[model samples]
Target: MISKSKVTAKLSVIDRFLPLWIFVAMGLGVALGRVYPAIGPALDAVKVGGVSLPIAIGLFWMMYPVLAKVRYGKLQSVSANGKLFGASLAFNWILGPILMFALAWLLLPDQPHYRTGLILIGLARCIAMVLIWNMLAKGSGEVAALLVALNSVFQILCYSVMGWFFITVVPTWLGAESTEFHVSMWEIAKSVLLFLGLPLVAGALTRVGFVRSRGEEWYEKKFLPKVGPAALLGLLYTIVLMFAMQGDKIVSLPFDVLRIALPLVLYFGIMFTSAFLLSKKLGFSYQETASLSFTAAGNNFELAIAVAIGLFGISSGEALAGVVGPLIEVPALLALVYLSLWLKDRLFPADVRANETAEPKDQATSLAQGGQLR
Candidate 1:
């Protein structure tokens, strides 16, 4: 088995530079689109239900590695940290959505498409990347694993339904006439079925098949590394195609991207701070708080981008807003990871009776055992 130090070292390079890589890919995509105009659209024509087929393939790759790591069967572990679980659920589902909706409405009143994009992003919480962020912050891997598993399941269940309501029904209720463009509930369901359903099933099968056959250790440390940066690879591929189709907009109104990013930045910062404070108030341990904070803060940009393109077309403002989510989120999350660590030292000192034992319990110890301070 690999040591924790080795795992950290291995992941550091990719995690640290993810934002830089995304921006580089974005620029490359814009450049290619501007330079080779015909190639971008020809690829766009290869679509089934508004999403570019090429982009969908990349989206699958982006989503698959994330889904593969989730252990939906481990939900029994959830009762071990009911407080942690409840706080996370309340923040992610209740407060997070309302906050982002307010931000989108207050900030982008004039840009209805951008408002819709941000709302979609808000409805879809982070299922995959928060695991990495939680690990980087020295949070409990077990708690992080549980949070991610819960989020993944919740995402599949609620994303399409909440999405249909918010993206379609809620907007009209709020008196946003721009939704008159007419997106059917069937269309939204189809998009969800394609974007999230396929990768989710594929990842589940791969996880069960590999673990039952090769044992969990080899399936995780060995097989997982072999699929390094699957998220980034898929992200870069889709970014290239997305920008390829939207080159003209990038060239003409570069600042518009910044407008889309504004609400996202606010969303991340607000969620992180609110969750952090709530964790502290609830007397959670440093690591537990870190996991909770990151869970509440991070996003599932892969699903957002895929659904954006599928629902709004590859070149729509919605897709661009979805793309900018990661551009801002990567650096924002990296910075927050550091902040969480620093806070562990100062804001919430490690004085738990459990840790004073000088003999740490197993990583997966339940909260009832006083393990890792749920």
Candidate 2:
């Protein structure tokens, strides 16, 4: 059995480096965009048979380690945490999109495609990054894993619904042409399966094999450490290609970043605040509340970007918004992680302090007693 203290220590090391890894990836992505436009287009060759697909290479690798560690049985554990589950579902599905729509309308520039792109990005909730947040907050790994699975399901089902609503319904509300709002459900489903589903399945299988063959301890100590850097590198490589492909558009539309940044900031602020309040009212401990808050705040840019490219083409301002979302999100999330630590210290001070020195036998005895009660 993995002790909480050991898990906490390992997470501290990961927390120290995760922000840097994400920023490095973003920088590399930008550099790649600047250097090789054609190379960016070439990287999209991964497809099912001959049909071209929209897979985010970096996102896939980044999620691999987390998926590998997922205990399949944990899915069943979610029922025990219904309030937390309800809170995540409410924020991600209910409040999340509404806030995104409002943010896009209020903050994103007047450009139509760019506005749509921000909406798409916001509609997709964070699947992988939230896990990192949960880990940093010392949340239940089981709850985090369940959220990943739940978000993956919602991303596929709701992407088309939310996309069409934004494109069609929102335009009508603003007295624009609803007739021109066009995105096929088939295309959205295919993109979700190819980019999101494939990586998820691959990661799950990898996790199962690693646990069975090498055992959890070996997998945790040896394999898990390496997965983080590898995923970050993959994301960086993919981001570079994306930036390279869209470098010209990015440079030409200098204010695009400013425009995109607004909706993102608004969305993050609204979602984080809402989740934090709900967690408190629901009486969640500080750690769990932090996990809920960040999970609500983060967006799943990888899925959103893929769908944006598929729907609006890679050069569309919409796709650019999707790309920019992560650039803003990474640093913001790091800040939130620190904020979570601070909040945890204030509200639940016990979480931050080092454990008192205790003999191994005594610790084992305590754990055994607790297990017997359960």
Candidate 3:
């Protein structure tokens, strides 16, 4: 078994201060935008179906490593942790969108564009960054990986449908003004196919091909260790580019961050509490609970940002809301990581942790036949 302590011991400076890196990237982006006003409009012109090609390049890099590391084989093991998976599915898919709609309606009834933005954010689920969050929180990497794989695939399938229903259908159904434009499923699918679908298949192929060539041991111990951090670097670059593109918009709205943040903050806080309390009620161990809660609470803001820009123009309120997601999510999830560690000790206790340790391993095995060693 790969020693968990050894893995933790190898933490680099980059990993230690991911939050700082994210914010610094944001600040740098804003500075660049202010310094060079022409840069944003120039970059915005490069879009196919609302997805920026330049941003897509960086995002692909960010997504690939995370997907590459996911033991798609563990998908089979998902059933092994049916309770956790089931709860996560409900939280992420069904309840997540509904809650956001309600919250946005309550919080920003007059701000239609912002409401649509929050709704879009709710529809997208996190796949890449939660792996980092889970690892930081000392949660189950295997389960986390499994959830990422599952969520990634699920997002491609559900995002457009959920978005349409919530943004256009639900509002119209409830007798509110429909702010949704012509967001066809094909457009959504195309963006998802390019952004998420390709990375997933490529990652799987890379994993299987390399493991076959180099052996499973080499793939995990050598290959993964070398390539895994690329995902985070990709995320940082993408953030910089995103903010650089939207820095002026973000800066102009002096209190908009607070305004945009209000509903999202409530969303994160409540989603986490609901997930945490539900996990405990369902008799989950610390690791299982952590994985479940993180999966539910984390929004795949990368995909959200892409979809927003695609569906709503880059300068639209929808896109800006999508941009704000990472700003709020990075720090908030970090705090939750610490909170989860505390909860694990106080709530889960020793016996529970010991008993649940094997759960992810078993799941990992079913997914990859011989997934990454824990």
Candidate 4:
């Protein structure tokens, strides 16, 4: 029997208390912003190709380690997974974005800026943290890694076009008011390259190089553990800086945060539940169902935050909406992690559940010890 505590115990201290840390980081950022009115400007003064240097570093740091953990060597097998691939693409690119757009507008008809922010998040997709949620729930790591790689490619290619379409074209089609803001595809593409592309390349190179030189066993068991925790540190740093950048807005507009959170909560719940049920109906194993659920439920908040700050200014409502994303996601997904485990017992066959739990202890314990919960 996998007790709830046993399942959660695999997570590192950082992953276990991620929501608390994020809240603390938010409070700290808000306090820093309040203490130093000029902090935002001072940080913004230094730019690397138009992005603030500090923020760029934070984004790269947040993304690279998590990406590095991907098992790229197994990607060759992904070509055989026709049904899984088709289903994932449909859920992630099609259903995910449309659902968020509807929820954002339905929930926040008055707040266009925040609505736009949530829509941007939906289009971004989950390439980073879904691995953690998938792994902790005893999902198929290889499939999750493949999905992450697939999403990364699609993200680089489609995110800008999707952003333009949802933010500009859809609003016009509906005869609704679009914001005065205009973001060229080139502008968004540049942000995606700097924020998502570079780190992805670096992470891939790191994994390949290390595996070749030191062997896969050494890389996964030793190297991954050392670097895994850094991802959280980068996340906390970026959150604090983002909140500090818009501290005044966040502090004054506490209710706005709650308003933005409502659609997000609905989005996560709907996506995860639908994906789980759909995967089960399609006859995927518990591992695949859990992987699909997490992949469907999670969003690439780091990319959203970076793009929001770059295109819409650091203190813009879009950026605040981006910042509020993980605040709701961490708790929601953590609960889903437990829910996935619970469903494994009830919905899946004993034979399939037995196979998952029977995975070699060495590999499982290594991952848990290495703190792979990015």
Give me the overall lDDT of model 3. 0.74
Best by lDDT: 4
**Overall lDDT per candidate, in order of appearance:** 0.71, 0.65, 0.74, 0.78
Candidate 2 residue-wise lDDT, 47-89, digit = tens:
5411223335455665565555556666675557888888899
The parts of candidate 1 lying over 4 Å away from their true place are: 1-19, 47-50, 66-74, 127-212, 216-221, 228-247, 285-291, 299-323, 344-374
lDDT of each residue in 236-348, candidate 4, tens digit only: 89778866766877667889999999999999999999999999899888877888889988998867877888778777889889978876886688778878877886899
Q: For residues 258-333, what per-residue lDDT tens digits would candidate 1 score against the true structure?
A: 8888888899999999899889999988877988899899877766766787678767888778867776786688
Q: All predictions: root-mean-square deviation over Cα? A: 6.4, 6.3, 5.2, 3.8
* Per-prediction TM-score: 0.70, 0.79, 0.82, 0.80
Residue pairs in collision within model 2: 29-239, 29-240, 33-243, 33-244, 58-234, 58-235
Candidate 3, residue 99: lDDT: 90
Which residue pairs does candidate 3 place in steric collision? 73-367, 73-368, 74-367, 125-300, 126-300
Ranking by TM-score: 3, 4, 2, 1
Judge candidate 2 at residue 167 and give its lDDT. Answer: 73
Flag clash pairs in model 1.
Answer: none
Question: Which should have the higher TM-score, number 2 or number 3?
Answer: 3
